[model samples]
Target: MFLPTTIEEVKKLGWKELDVILVTGDAYVDHPSFGVALIGHYLVSKGFKVGIIAQPDWKSEKDITRLGRPKLFFGISAGNVDSMVSNYTASMKKRKIDEYSSGGIAGKRPDRAVIVYSNLVRRFFPDVPIVIGGLESSLRRFVHYDWWSDRIRKSILVDAKADLLVYGMGEKTVLEIAQILSRTRDIEKCKTIRGVVWWSSKKPIDCHELPSFDEICLDKTKYAESTRLQTILTDPFKNIVLCQRQDSRYIIQNPPQLPLEQEEIDNLYLLPFERKTHPFYEKIGYVPALDMIQFSITCVRGCFGSCSFCALTQHQTTHVVSRSVDSILEEVRILTKHPDFHGIITDVGGPTANMYGSSCFVRETKGQCEKFCLHPKSCVNAKTNHERYLELLDKVRTINGIKHVFVSSGIRHDLVLNDPHGDLFIKKLIDFTPGQLKLAPEHSHPKVLALMRKPSVELFLEFKEKFEKYAKNSGKQRYVVGYFIVAHPGEGKRENEHLRKFIEEKLNYHPQQIQIFTPSPGTVSTAMYYSEIDPFTKEKVFVERSLKLRNAAKANLMSLNSAR
Candidate 1:
């Protein structure tokens, strides 16, 4: 059943008032892939009356006040993707289509939707506690870089005037906040919860203090230092509290919530998701995002790959978690029985496909390592075996109504090279891929790859040879599609030319997956872009600030000869 969006629906459920109301920037789709839906369902399972108001008209009080006000709090999310990224392109151009909106229409959600929605709620309710979360709030919980305004902005919690901010995958943190508010109606009690950030007039004690907002704004070196500290201290087991002063108040961030265990994640996915777009959007048109994943299954959550440009490190954390094989197979059977079900499964993986059951024993016993697991070299403590994933795939293929099960998510090629049974895994993966496999090598030059924290291109070449050999033995016409980034930090004209020549001579095909580097908030790459200095090494780096040069580099790579 869909969550009540109007007062009539609430009355039909025999509820006088809801305990929580969720406001999102995207059209409501009651699917697990949608963050607001997943969170709403989880909250409902905990015996709380929950309602949702999606993409409310920010200019007025009509949609925002339709459900009245909740008893506990108003949960604000910017939807599946960050609002700014959803509304604009890498070139800072206004986007014309929003896949998450009704009929793929744009302009439904305002830029900085979280801040706008929070302000809208406050204008009406005036007294209700507002808690902000999701990708946009999660990454902006600190004073970080903003590419759109081309300046540093305060932590979004302060700008939104929210009572509290929940970061990371917020299932655990948000529940705690809701319970505390229900019991005492005191926002102060939620300050110590893991994965939460709140403002305080007094400075916190025994916490790692980052550079003040004024200091970071004045000194680029301090900004780089703050970014480095936040990146390395994300381990929940370490119990690290972060504090940064923004004016008279201090924003106190508690340690991240512990990564969910296998059983916990399985139960969360097994919630009674309707797996359909809400009837409210019927007249508006079909949502494009739902169509892509209606038949897909999310078999995993969280990623361990700590790429510099990727926000998964901040939003999902570096802890890899997977659902049980039984749980996944059960979901697959359910998908087969859906009204829109066909024989084909579009995808069955998470952030990285092949890292389904991967883990690090040392980190489990100790804490996060200073070095990344698969960056410069694979860590000795890391387990790179793919046996469990291969077993799951083999079992899934035997289901009664299943025809084709595809692994559509991008796989970390470095992990595949390190796995003992990688060759067999590659042979199996070919049967599922729809003619093209997605691989992100990022760049061909070593200096550029180092700045991006990706593995060397030599590893990519080695994996390409093995993939071709396997495809030939299976007698299938398959190809390896590469994703690259142009105009990233440390990429000068010489580096760009080197990558272009390598793409022409080595891959010998026109690349369609190239993107210009976008300096989003809370990423090491963005720190380098703003500071023009590498955070880890403290060395000066070259940054292309001109919009024309960045576009020219991408065009140069795209116009390569397809001599395959």
Candidate 2:
């Protein structure tokens, strides 16, 4: 059932007051992929009365105060993606539309919606506890670089004046916070909750103190140093409480909560979701983002690739957690029974499709900060196997009333290359791909790939050869689509030219769409974009600063010979 969004809906629930009110930038989508809906659904399952205020009008207190007051706290999320990144393009120009909004319209939510909503709630209900989560808060939990302003900004917790900032996959942490606050009705006492960052003037004895916000702002290198420290402390097993002084008070981030186990993840996914936008938006229009994933299933929660430009490393963490096959099949049965079932399953993957059931043997013991599992080289301990995933796909294919089970989510080609049984996996993948199999090779130039922490281009070439050989043998007319990013840090005229040449000469394909590197908050690439120095090596790196140059590089890549 959908959560109450209006006073009338709340009255239908026969509740005069709600335990929690979730405010999000995106229109309310009750799919597991949507953060606001997932959190709201989970809270309801735990017996808390929840209401949603999605895309509330930030211009006035009317929309913010429409839900009345919550008994516990106000949960604010900037939807699935960061609001600034959502509202603007990589070049910092305002975007024309938001895919998450109804009818695919723009300006539904304000820029920096988390801070905006939190401030709005604080204004109307001065003493109510405000808790912020989702990508905006998680990635901005530390003092980090801001691409829009081209400078360092304080943690979102400090800017929003939120009572608590839940970072990482926050299901466990949020539930604990809610339970504690439900009894105490105090926000300050809710500190020290795992996976949450709260403001505290008193420094704990064992906490790791990051550079002061002022120091990082004055010195770019200090900012880099703080980021390096922050990355190392992402492990849930051995992480220390991290404290960074924003102004007078310090932002104290507790140790991350361990990712949910297989059973827990299965239970979470099994929760009943309306799996569509709320009916209130019927007059407004349909959400394009919801349409894409409405028939899709998310089989995993986190990414292990840890790409330099991606924020998954911070928000979803480096740990790989997956659901049970039985649970996945159960969800598939539910999907098959859906009224809109079209005899096809859109996707059955997560951050990376092939990373399901893949993990390091010592993940619980040592932690994930040693080095990347895929980049440089696949770690010896990294279980790079596709048998389980292939098995899951095969089982789903034979289910009654399912015609085709395509993997829309992009799988890592490197992991596929590492798999000893990769040949069979590729053949099965070709049979399932709707048209073109998507691969994110990110860049073709070696120097650029190194900066992005992506695998070498040779791997991509080898994978392409294998995919073609398998596709030809299977007699299936399938294409291997590649995604590349231009103007990333360390990509200059020479690097861009090299990449373009390689795609034309070796790959023999022209990309229909190109992406300019967007340096969102709390990413290693964003830090490099701001500091002009690699965080790990502290060595100077080249950065393409001109928007014209970035756009020119993108145009050059796409203008390559179309059907070579």
What clash count goes with each model?
0, 0
The model with the greatest lDDT is 1
How well does model 2 score by local distance difference test?
Answer: 0.87
Q: lDDT value for candidate 1?
A: 0.89
**Candidate 2: worst-modelled 10 consecutive residues by lDDT:** 555-564
Candidate 1: tens digits of C-alpha lDDT, residues 433-507: 888887999999999999899999989988887887788888998888799999999998999999988888888
lDDT of each: 0.89, 0.87
Work out the TM-score per prediction.
Answer: 0.98, 0.98
Off by over 4 Å in 1: 561-564
Which residue pairs of candidate 1 clash?
A: none
Poorest lDDT segment (10 consecutive residues) of candidate 1: 555-564
